[model samples]
Target: MYRSEFYVFDQDKPVPVIIRNYTQDDFDELIQIQSECFPPPFSSELWWNKEQLSNHVMRFPEGAICIEVDGILAGSLTGLCVDFDPNHMEHTWEEITDHGYIKNHNPSGDTLYIVDISVRPRFRKFGLGKLIMQAMYHVVIQKKLVRLLGGGRMPGYHKVADTLTPQQYLNKVIKGDLKDPVITFLLRCGRVQIGIVENYLEDEESCNYAALMEWKNPFNRT
Candidate 1:
C-alpha cells in the first residue's frame, strides 16, 4: 500500500522536486530526516508496517511529494483524499489514523487530510515549508479535493502544569521547548486554531491539550 518513487539527479544544479507519490525505497532517508525534524518521530519499523504503509499509496501517481536540494531529500508532505466522517468511524483499529474523529464529529466531505509534513532542521526558516504548503494546495485543487487540515500542539514552555506527567505526553503539550519554531511557522501559513484535545498526545501525563487548526481551501476559486 505504501509506495515511493525517486527522481534521480544527474547534474549538480538545484534538483527540481515535483510533488508526487512515495515508494519503499525512500524509507531509509525518510526515517533519518524525520528523526531530525520531530522530537519523537516515527521509527523505521513503524514506517515499514503494511497497514501504515498502505494508507499512503495514492491511486494516482502523485500521491505525495518530497523536496530535494542538490539531489538530497530535504522535506516531504503526505496527504489523503477521502470523504471522511469522524462520527461514524473509530480510530482504535488503525495502526495510524487521520482526522477520523474530527470528520465524524464535524462531518466534512471530500477532505484532503495532510498526514505528515516536515522539513529538516538545516532547511528551516527558508520558506520551504510555505512552498510545500502552496504545492499541496495546488495539487488538491488539480485533483478537486475539497478541504485541508493539519496542526501541531504547542504546549507553552517552562509552564508545564503539575497535572501532566511523563515526558512523552508532556512533550506534545509543551511545545515551547523544542517545537516553537514549527508551531509559529504553521500559524504564519494562515492556519487557525480550532480546539485543544486534552491529554491527547502525552503518554504519561495525566492531561494536556492539542491545538487544532484548519486552513481554508486556498485553491478554492470563489
Candidate 2:
C-alpha cells in the first residue's frame, strides 16, 4: 500500500517522502544507498547479492518498504513475519534472512522481524531512520501483528569493546550512563533491549555482537 508519510527539506526546497511498496525499479538505487550507508566488513554490498534482493522482492513484496525523497531513493526498511521462540537464541543476519527469503515466514505469526534499515550517508541525520521504523510499525499494526523484532549493531560498541561486554555496554546505553547514537535513539523511540546476539554481523564495532531488540505494538496484543 502507498502512504505519503511526510516531507523533508534540502536548501529550502521541500522534499516529499513517499513510503511505499518495493518495486523492481527500486533495486539498483537501493543497492547503491545500502553501499553508501555502510562501510567495509559490514557493507551490504559484500553480502547482499542481486539474486538475494530479487528473492526478497519476490517473497515479501510489501515487506520491503522504501523511502523516496525529492523523487530519489533515500532510505528503506525490510522485514518478515515469523513465529519464533522467546527463549530461542538470537540469530545472525544470514540465519534470520536465509538469502533474503526467511524460511520460517509464518504469515499468521505474531512477530514482525525487521531484517534491515538503512539511510544514505547524505540523508543520515534527517530522522529518516525513525521514519523507517514508523513505516515498519505501521506495517505491524496494519497486519495485526503484536510484536516487532530486530537486531541492532552498535557502532559505538567498538570504542568500548575492550572494556565492556556487549550486554554491559547495552546497559550503559539503556541507563543513559553512556550514549550510543543508534541504540540510544531506538531506545528513546520505545524499543526495549531484549538481549545480545553474538556473531550478528561481521562488523568489529560490536565485537560481532548485536543487541536483540523489540518494540511492542501498543494497540495490538499477543
Each candidate: RMSD to true structure?
A: 7.4, 2.1
> Mind sharing the TM-score for model 1?
0.62
lDDT against the true structure, each candidate: 0.52, 0.79
lDDT of 2 at 157: 90
Candidate 2 lDDT at 184 equals 86
Estimated TM-score for each candidate: 0.62, 0.89
Candidate 1 per-residue C-alpha lDDT over 74-155 given as tens digits, one digit per residue, 9 for 90 to 100 = 8877665556443532222121234321222212246665666878887664556776776667666666665566535454
Candidate 2 local lDDT, 150-191, one digit each (tens): 888898998988899888999999988999867987886579
Off by over 4 Å in 1: 1-19, 39-51, 58-63, 82-109, 157-179, 203-207, 218-222
- Which candidate's lDDT is highest? 2
